[model samples]
Target: MGVCTSQNEAEKIENSEQDYQKLDFNRVSTYQKLENIANNIAAQQQIDTIFSSLIQRMIASRQSHILDMLEKMDSKKKQQFMTKLERIDFEFIDSLFHHCYKQDYPDVFSCNVVQSINSQEQNLDLIKKHKVGIVFLCGGRSSRLYDKLLSDIGLPSKKCVVQIMMERLKKVIMIASDNQEIVDYPIAIVLSDQNSEKFQMYLKGKRDFGFQSITFIFEKSLPVIDMKGQVVFEQENQAVMTPEGTGTIFLQLNSFINKFPNMEYIHFLGLDNLAGLPLDPQMLNLICKQKGDALCKVIETNSILDDRIFYFAKQFQTIKDQAKGIQENSQNLGQMCLNDLYLSVSFLNTLKQNHEKALKLNQRYHTIRRGNNIQFEKHIQDIIEVTDITILHQTDDFALLIDDARKAVIQLSNVHKRNLKLEGTQEKDLVEITPQMSYCRREDLKKIENATYPLII
Candidate 1:
């Protein structure tokens, strides 16, 4: 009887332990599912760092929490928990890491020159000697200017903004050199699918821009759908959507690099800023002098209102994982922010560093979650200062002489009328015309001259 009783007690203890194990597993499984869902959402939103941190926290806490719960659960309840845990896939964590870290590995830099900047003269020479690539980002909708690239601004010749810009660029290149072969650089004008056909047609008959090769790449648009999967802009016959932000440029950059293996530099500018100064060889020479990989043009903003006229600098966070004895807090990645300055090479380097760091973090986390704890420290690259040219004022004669001459002519025309004597006695509208009129009238006689006519004998 004593032997039989001992045997029963041993059986009961074994069953109890098994039940506790099952309950612990169930809790872990549920937590894992919640984590996986969160990770998926993060990846879709491109919140890579946040997702990695959350996943690491959940996994680390899982084992301890499950073991604690086992100590309190009854045998029957424990078995139920085990069944629930069985439904959760342990392999999911591995899969999540892989999905989040796609393209996280660094690519080999095989190109002779990873980055190069050439002036209008040198650029011409470079294009002649090597394959060159150009990318024009045109993804913006005509929200501000009524969707017209060629709308007349009431000028006498009815020259549109884009037309004027193209003309000035052509003139600048002509002045740079007489070589016609410089047009060989492959120009890719990135446009949206909605505007692709229209843009292509616009470029079809116009042949004088002096570009030897031109290609248009259309960005894929995603439909704006609601939580129920219903399209938001269904009422409109055409799809209504927002243009994906400028981040898409990096993706298309690879293709540009691939096509032009010897590509030294790329110039990117906006469409509406028609007042852009000519691509001077001096500016290009400055860029080349610093060995700058990327260059951006900046115009000084004088007032609060002018701030909107300039693109603001971006701030990025540097993060390191804490679980692997790494620092996990966000730190400011670059230099102190400055006001009134335009974006330059330092700004571009910040962006490049942010991209590279994010990629490394993804790879590190991916390896870690797969039960491989390889310690990889993440660091942001330091940005070097390069030359920053304040875009000369539109009224500055050097820039005005080349591009804004027509606008200057309009100003001069108004001044000419203001100085004329009128028969009617009326308070002169000096407030509206005083400063420019007063200055022009005082200088007009001395400055204006007519060609001497040949005298008839």
Candidate 2:
């Protein structure tokens, strides 16, 4: 026992394991109380007031264990946690303790039924009638490639990933507008704080890419929790935080979407999806035709698929098993849904309203080790519970997911050999291509047949 710390508290805990077990700890009630206290403290402006209230609540609730833990931590660390108390979610942290330390798992729902769209032409016609916007999900920090976007085909150009995506979006906008010029088409980029500034800087004063209304929304970040469920600090006074799962975007973007009353559908795509053309006219037609609220494009995977690819896409099995209506197909390994999605603005509103129902669908938290700290992560796939979505299953993988530089090189090489039919003894990183080059269509590659290495198109 340290003389500087709570010696009496240490003696009580060490006296008997049974006494610790007997401590009611009623976690659910404790969490409710803590959540209330936290909300009250957060509303206050004064730091001293906040800390005093937090301490008083803990003592009043007879949460001696938490007090003991806080006492064991150095005064400076405690001060840091208390100072940043508003940013921390005590309920979430308490749940993490139940999951990580107590081996308690959240309920998982299984979906077994699969439904398909009957008429594509009908859906296409419906798409033309409704006004659609685009939701670009690219909230992740580029921790791997040292760049936010990378091209597999070595394209020598000043265009960044955002630029390339916008170029494609220009095509999408023209096509969606039937080759006529349109203005104020909504496009929102959901990104993390780490990359939001970089993206805004890159986009500032640049051409709108045929889009007048472009919104940049930052994803919510949560404090990192240690194994003991204590919040971790990155610096002397700064608490480490990671972006919450993609599902939280609805909460963040709901109010923003309300600003555009005419926007009916949201075409969701990932920034890293090099080949996924957003505002797809055909997909819009189909979803609108079916009168579906949401459309999710999932790739059917088998054991033959690469493990990295499997990990990259969230497993469709979780959806099939947990979600009630989806039926299973025994022929394939499982379906994997990338970020390529088309959702109705109405459904997004419904999802935002039923956020609690979405949370109850699954406890998809995974413990990730970042540097010296362990952080819990949640996923957006939880929204499947609330949304009535149409699944578009594809046999071949169309999403050219280029997350890192190494994957960019590998994917680029494959594209050259398969689509361009230009397999030669060339360095992988040296070959260059762009979306404007072929749009991943083989017929478009005819013009590039005679292209040489260090190829720039």
Candidate 3:
């Protein structure tokens, strides 16, 4: 206990020293000039008084660091620093600068991609004319199945998991045709560089799946190597990792926005859900009706031990703004608090209320080390509403959570079924192909065809 206490004390002292170093103002040259400009900008404030005060506090806090940097620099270095400072426009930086120090912003951040709520209402007829885009994030290795995404599963006809998923989606598209209120959308499968060739082969000339349009996009991959410069997996020789997270979907959607600028909604699904049981177009339509930006699908489980369902909460943090040099004490660094928030339709609505800045995304796998061993587990959750998209938390039982279930259903049979099917089954046939396939197929195919034709010539 004594040793632990001493270590804690030492850490506290070290942090304090670091803070003092940050407070030193003599090392900076343009500190005074920047400080004066900030003060002048604040003085000319035609904006909110609170905003002005916040700016003032930030400038004052940063003054010490500026002075410290100036005092330590030589004349030549000081001139260079001033030139750099000139490029740092206070207004432009202020707009992009999220105040991590105060946690003043809300958990959700909504982009103005869609024009306006009123506009959507007025153009309901027009918006309904277009189909929703379906994007599947299928860029992961099928280590669990020990094959590529196109491998045949142990079923009759040997249909791979990806094929089954595509077939099920075809069923949904068929059902959607009867409903004139919704438009038909295409299915875009996102593949990583490693599995592109195999996927193309599986999909080639097979248009019977009935998707309006089927396209593929490549997710960039990174190689994993050991300290000795040996590749981790021979298959992954030049393989890359998955994009940062599912949140990357937002970034990917930007490219299509111009062409389909009027698209009001997008439906995202995981590639592994082979059975495709839970994703109902009607439920998605209902969510759109409720004006939700993003809708998360959820299922209730009898066993509290199930790791799939995520409870949302708000996380708080106080951050130091290095640009403004202001430490606004301790403030809430708001995030969707995963552990505290309950699973319900109401909770979904609550998130949508703050949808402008909130990101509705999922974390796939989490790694943990136990003593000398390491373990990995899937952390899957249902529909994450990104914008004001309404979330329909469809459950089988309404009486189970009568106080909270808004769109819950009750069954006539006495057999109690509380859980709603949330996720589709993962098809096992999708194998993880090596990067060599991508490079080899292009070169080898050309050589074989050319060699065969040369004899005839």
Highest TM-score scorer: 2
Winner on TM-score (2 vs 3): 2
**lDDT tens digits by residue: candidate 2, 228-303:** 5566655444666777656567656676677777778877777655556666665776676656666766665543
- Name the better of 1 and 3 by lDDT: 1
Q: Pick the candidate with the highest lDDT.
A: 2
Summarize candidate 1's per-residue lDDT along 1-457 as a digit string, tens digits.
0123322333322112233234343555534434444454335334443434343333432322332343555655645544443333334333333442333553211111111223323344533444333455566455334545655654444555456555555554544455354455556776876677777666675763666667666654433323222223323122234343333454465566566666555555444343343343444554556544434443233323211123222222222324434331113122122211112323343445586643542332211111222111111111212212222111211111112434433433343333343122222211112221222223343332331211000
Instruction: Give the lDDT ranking, best first.
Output: 2, 1, 3
Per-candidate TM-scores read: 0.44, 0.70, 0.41
Q: Candidate 3, after superposition: displacement of residue 185 in Å?
A: 4.0
Candidates 1 and 2 compared by lDDT, better number: 2
Instruction: Please write out the lDDT profile of model 3 over residues 304-398, one tens digit for every residue.
Output: 32122233222112233366343332121211212111122333334445544334343223332223322223222323333232232423311
Of 2 and 3, which scores higher on lDDT? 2
